[model samples]
Target chain A: MTNLTSLTIRQALDGLKKKDFTATELTEAHIKASEAARHLNCYITETFDHARKQAKESDARYASGRAGLLDGVPIAMKDLYCTEGIQTTAASKILEGFKPPYESTVSGNMFRDGAVMLGKANLDEFAMGSSNTTSAYGNVINPWRSEAEPDKQLVPGGSSGGSAAAVAARIAMGATGTDTGGSIRQPAAFCGITGIKPTYGRCSRFGIIAFASSLDQAGPFARTVEDCALLLQSMAGYDPKDSTSVDRPVPEYFKAVGQSVKGLKVGVPKEYRVEGANPEILALWDKGVAMMKDAGAEIVDVSLPHTKYALQTYYVIAPAECSSNLARYDGVRFGLRENTDNGNLNDMYEATRNAGFGKEVKRRILIGTYVLSAGYYDAYYNKARRVRKLIWQDFINAYQKCDVLLTPTAPTPAFAIGENTADPVTMYLNDIFTIPASMAGMPGMSLPVGLSADGLPLGLQLLGKPFEEETVFKAAGALEKAANFTALPQSLMDKAA
Target chain B: MSIDINTVRKVAKLARIRTTDADAEVLSGELNNILSMIEQLNEVKTDGVEPMTSVIEMNLPARADEVTDGDMPDKILSCAPEKAAGFFVVPKVVE
Candidate 1:
């Protein structure tokens, strides 16, 4: 009765085990909270029936003393992940009625571990944009609004915007997100939740809708670092279905949550201090360094010279891959197919795509096609690929100097919706700090460190070596304790209630 | 690196997505703007660098050529927009 929705996943699990509350009670609380917060627009589909059924099943599991890792824990899934019977839209009209006959490997793993589906969270259309404005479902309003102008709606950072918002608003204990280019971290930073994109192939990408195959990695967004670790524990594994999935053993990530970073060397990259970044964000970065230093980790300055070119490289590579991946959505197979009375096959393809895709999606597809076209391939696509290698090498060189790298998650705190939507270049700049890690296939996470001048949450990102999520979690855990970020958007939740 | 309307039309056709003259004109301007930002890649010099195809430099794992999956044509075609006897229906290729 005392706001069961407010409890973290760990607390919820413990309560379920102790018989202090039933999974149905917890699921009901969250369902009521999600209903009250309709204005947030975080969920594209609210699976009330599915959640109630799953919670009831979990209660049965508890009765038999056979509870799984996440038994009865209510959480949200990013709409991009295909759920067998559920409509997985990927926040695009192109996938509006798409009911995948099979579940994504990652989601299948989570369900096997006893996680309940609160619903599918909204995202950028095909996970294309930095802001949730590109979602055909609607923009997901951030639960964290500026103190001075509480009426002014802010954007929950994107492609994982809804996942971050749902967790921040306490509608769900945790949520799943995928990062192609800062989708998870940027939105997590904006909404003041903790999110991590594990190393590429750490978690299978079998069922999650592909954005850029090379960079798209599924991850979790939770209220705390430890919660993220627990969620990732179940999510990360090897699956033959996903060819890129590493055959390495999935480490006990949750055990690394509270490990000390006493003698660890933390690298502060100089290139992250880009021109025109917010002074408050820079101060927060310094504050993060101080926090880590106080926790007995040595902070050393290192340089990744190719960091500045990461955004440009990502724009080219991601779009090129997207252009190829999205080609599967022609009218004949599945999803939306425009009915152009008596029109030819080609006309249906064009009409369906033109109608189904949003502006950003179309823009990316066009850019992708142009770059991979004859005569332009070498100058654009090939050049970007080489630059991507240089970007990877830059991280490789920096990691030799320290065990992990630290930087601000974004240039500033979350901006108001539509602020940068008109200018695609301005929008792409939001990903500057988070892109290099994606290009290098390293694990990266963003956790709230402090508040901005407007009293909005600001996050600091930590980058670890390839498949080295444990190190990142250990360092982030120490910083989380040092920072003691206890701020929550309770007022927003209360208003919604 | 600037793109013109003619290039936009050509590329749109290549992508098999329909566009009108006005949409192509607007797309051209948008493409040029994006291309200008992407043109920054030229600033980096990578004479001997190999164009990285993927992050982990491993050859794709080979699998035995065996029937690991099959026997669900109905399930696979469940979401098809138009379907006929065990196949996806599309506009006629011949008159």
Candidate 2:
């Protein structure tokens, strides 16, 4: 049973297919694990009954010889995804008690593929913060460390923090995560797990709560590279409901895993070696290069000179788009609303938003509005857009020399929760490595490498060209196999027991 | 590039967020600091550059003139704070 907790989705499904374990038994193990890991605060809601019913159906399907690849797999959905009648809060006060009429395309797709939904995972409010502290419900503690290590209460990385923590804690075999800037990869790195943000438009965003439409993308978080690939295979597809969704055919993602990395051109961007990056992080990058070289990959020096501008451009572009996308959340619509005087329209809007949104959310909305405001639009938003083009072009140029780009996922491992929260600017700096690929709409993945000197997990990031997720997965799969990073924090192990 | 308290207040109002006088004062300073940091963009020469909208350069697919969404007014309004006759209710504004 202990080893079963570490099994990948494919492994678990194979067990179910062979009747080595019933879907009900597997679901109960995951549910019990999730219940035991409650101290980590990874879940906002649990769907035990729903999970049981789904597992039973999967068992019935197996009995009927209709089992799918993920027939009996239990997965978690980030709270941001609408689950029909299930309350989708986006971890914000504004959307409290809100349930959607329709299910998000991704969640629906997962359910259709016979994936069992464990529950809604916690997240940064509206997927805004790098640390999970921004969640209105409260901060999700990193499950990787023990309570005795008081000083090491480092965050499980933001926005997707809950999803990452859930997987790391064995609360679920895998979970869905959305990445705008570094939400998916950074949190995955912080929690010492694997997360992939597929190319933009790979997954439909039809019913996922909007943060930054252009940058927001849904992906998967799991314990292993192979698990992440298997989850992505089911999640990636075209939906005409989402106009921006690509009409491209979904590929068999797992086929690329464990593929040879021989002759693979890996680009190491010089610009990512910024001044403030931790020395250990840079060392890990070298370690990753050596590991890849041992596996027959060729590491080449490439320049993404415009990488320095990614954070600034992302802040402007994301908030500007968020300001527009969040406009739909005004009290009169489908979420939380505060009552106002019957005659005053503006006051109603003001009271509802003011009472509903959190401080960070408000700050972003204000910043977004200021950038998109008439006179400043050209100076801030438009100028940021122009710089965005240069950033994308830089990636294009690098890919010409390399099949994939590798860099440190974050400048450092998870910092103390409140360390950088007070200063938003400092917190934004955390996204430096992951934001560039997002700016170019390329697929990116984070795989655990080794531990920092402080004994926290470190992660290496890989970037691939648009729609070339297989290359990213192959490279990540190779490194994951070679690195063999199995350092589950004693805290999580103790809780599992 | 410095923003004043009044400007911060106005921005907050436009964003539909309530702000106290002290918050506006603090935000004015913080906003100014952020804008100053953003000022670094001014140093780069972007002559004749067309503004980028999305990271991907492809044209967005256009939907045909067809309505495909399910009409579940009751389900949609189930989460609304105020609803009436299958429509979301808001304060009356126009004369």
Candidate 3:
């Protein structure tokens, strides 16, 4: 059998249906691949035992010809999702060794549909940093390397870095990711995989650890757009537990995967052409436009003037929401506690949070508190909130001109590790092109468009109107068929061998 | 606007996160850098624009008054740092 681990979710399902391989065999192959790829540090906790048991159950169901939608598929979950009786740290020491007694709505849905859990993938601490360097466990190294410097390690963009890395390396079939200010799409773009951040409230946020409530959303990362659509079909649904979860019925996402982009209006936002973006990325964006046009998509030039204010608006709003959401981590409840001798309540809260959170998390908390402070509220938080309306209005106006917007996913391909982590602002700028969609609560996707001269993958982002993920998927599927990106990291491919 | 050590310390206190004087000094520099970067938001004129609290623009839907969830304190308390008699143990506040 030619490397069962390399097959996409659809192919794996076909093999299982044909009885070519048992689900147990497929699960074991991925577990072995995951074991060999440990040097990448993509997973925080490997659920081999749990996966084996689930695979066995799936095999029995297959024998009886009673397979679920995602039966027998082995996948990774981003550590942000709460897996009952499994440690979900969100890659933060603050949540170290904390296992939820219940499953997150999205993960629970996947499990109910018979997806086997391979493990919990690592991410930035509290999903904060753009690079995976902020993970308390360790940085998840991108499997992709530039031709200029093969020895130099690159970041698998974050805070969904681990999920992106794992899927790219083929250690897991597909993985779940959350986007609060471009976490999912950015990492997927860097790792040369397909990922989508559904419009906010598409997936229930009931059990995912909160980073920024309003902007945070759970999505999927996969090697192919079809695989992402399959994973998202299971992950998205209405949940009474999460009040923000929309009551709309979940669409047949995979059905739209291969749908034609004929007569589709693809909007090219003029404002996304920033000054500092690499010429190679800009060229890839143009190629994406040409590909869409060839596929019968009308490439309309539209304007989103408020695009420039997205990063600043996101920095202020996400931190403010994070500051409020993370306040529950007092020494008393779940996770780590410190300073026992000091019987004072105030001292305990301070000691616990200070000892628990990492440097980046601490910085965000401080910035959030400062912006929302009594004196600075109107100057920073309120003003940013009002500007957020304008940013959303920019998209609302632009969508009226066309069906979807296309832009470069990031300014450049994956940069070397430790390249931008030194300066917090520089690190924040990594999501420059992707954050605007997140702020406006639109469904956005990233798929590989082409490779750079240095042999690194470049991705083009497609943004669709709210609750219109099928449009985004249809257009991206057309691009994926056109671009046909076939590069894989040689080192990880050798390791899998 | 530049953030000084005093400002960092004050915000840290308000956030209930412990920071030493040295940490405060370092944080002040870092916060100032981030603040200056985000200060660009002030440049965009948002006249007569209402602050958007939620993206969906819907009021919180009221539910009928009834018991929808609860009665599993054990599962909830299982994750507590310190628990006794089905209660999370915290440092005493009342003197």
Candidate 4:
């Protein structure tokens, strides 16, 4: 029998097609693994019966010779996605009981392609924090370490921490994740998996809950770059339902995955080599560049000087957009409504919002409202926006000399749970490496490089031109094959056995 | 740039989050600390720069001015804490 824990989506699909295993058997195995990995808190809500039903339908489709790329593949949807009739919380108390009547475009697309819905995974409330600790549902534990050191739990990263952890732990074949300021890439780096944040507007945001509408883009988290390509192939396309959805034709993501990266120009931004970056991370990034050079690729020095301004611009722009997007949850509209004294409208609004939103959500909204307010608008919001243009222009200039840009995915590996929570500024600084691409609305991905001295995973990021996800996958696929870091944390393997 | 308890209270009201006087005092210190850190942006000079709303400057496809959605009054009202016939109910403001 094939070791279910080690099988990739491509392997599982081939097995299912050859009648080596039924979709029901595959679904059951994954469910069993998910149950075994429950201590990690990877899933927020699991639909066992729903998954089985979808598996049976997929089996029926196979029987009728009507299968698709993702048929019967079990995948988890991040809680930020809207699932019809399923509770979608975004891991916040404000949306505690809110359930959407319709499915988001990405979820709907995946379902239509015959991917089995394993369950909804956990995330940072409204995808705000870099560490998963900010979730109201409790923190998701990283499953990569040994069980002997149970007390020494590493963070699974955020705001897509659960999605990354579940996929890394073999709880699911793959999972969908959204990236806004490195939500997907950073966590993928932390969890030692492959995650891609496609060029903005490549995937429709019609159903995915908004954070920073300008920067948020949905992609896939999986064990292999090829698998990420497969999931992205199915998840991306234009949808008229979303106003910002790009009208361009979807490219074949998997077509170029096996392409060689010989002679490809990779840029290393000098600005990313800053003080406070962990030495191990820098070493790993250097090793990655050397490996690429060995594989007949050219390493070029590129300048993205506007990188220093990315965090400042993102903080302002994202909060401003979030302030407007989160305004829909006024207690009377969709979620938790507080008890009101009579029908006093203003008081009612206040009570409902005060009772519904959490501390972090409130903080962002206040910051957003303050920056957008008349007296401070020019000083804060407009100034940040002006800097944002320069940041985008920086990428346009860098892409001229390189096919892809490379950097450490994060400054350091995952920190302890409560370490950075008290200091919001330090927490925001964790996004330094990941935000530049997001601010410029370009496609970026994180591929596992190696482990740090402490045994935690390190990640290498690849930045590509807008809508040129194929280039990223081609380069990432090359690196992944060359590095071949197959060291799964002992905890996951022991549980599987 | 130092935030105070009064500013915290005003910001809390504007954000529609209820905060106690004690909470405001604590928040005043915290918000001021955060602002002090964010004030680093002021060090960079950005005179005569155009404000950027998006990374790309392509013209977005415009939809015709036609009604594409129908009334979902029942669905809309389903989320309301207080509702009347075909509408969400709130406190009387003008009267």
> Candidate 1 — which pairs collide?
none
Candidate 1 C-alpha lDDT tens digits along A1-497: 56798788888888999999999999999999899888899999999999999999999999999999999999999999999989999998988888999999999999999999999999999998888999999999999989888878999999999999999998999999999989999999999989999999899999999989999999999999989999999999999998899989988888888898998999999999888878999999999999999899998989999998999999999999999998988988889888787768888888988888888888899899999999999999999999999999998999998999999999989999879867788899999999999999999999999998788999999999999999999999999999899887745655657
Q: What TM-score would each prediction reach against the true structure?
A: 0.98, 0.97, 0.98, 0.97
Worst 10 residues of 3 chain A by lDDT: A488-497
A61-144: candidate 2 lDDT, tens digit per residue:
999999886888998899999998888899988888887878999999899889999999999999998998888888898876
Off by over 4 Å in 3: A493-497
Candidate 3: residue B73 lDDT (0-100): 96
lDDT by residue for model 3 over B22-95, one digit each (tens)? 99988988999999988988788988999988889776767899997899999999999889999988888777
Displacement of the residue B18 alpha carbon in candidate 1, Å: 1.7
Q: What's the DockQ for every one of the candidates? A: 0.82, 0.69, 0.84, 0.61
Q: Model 2: per-residue lDDT, tens digit, B1-95? A: 77898899888888877788998987777677667767677766677888877665578677677877767776666777888887878788677
DockQ of 4: 0.61
lDDT of 4 by residue, A1-497 (tens): 88775799999999989999999999999999898888889888888889999999999999999998899999999999999888899998878867787899998988898999888999988998898887889899887662344467888889999999999898899999999999999999989999999999899998788998989999999999999999998999999897778878877788878798999999999999998778899999999999889877899999998888788888888888998888887776677777666767778778887777767777788777777777888888888888888888899999999999989999988777777766677788889999999999999999898987767788999999998999999999889988898978768656558
**Which stretches of candidate 1 lie above 4 Å from their native place?**
A493-497
Task: Provide the DockQ value for model 1.
Answer: 0.82
Better of 3 and 4 by lDDT: 3
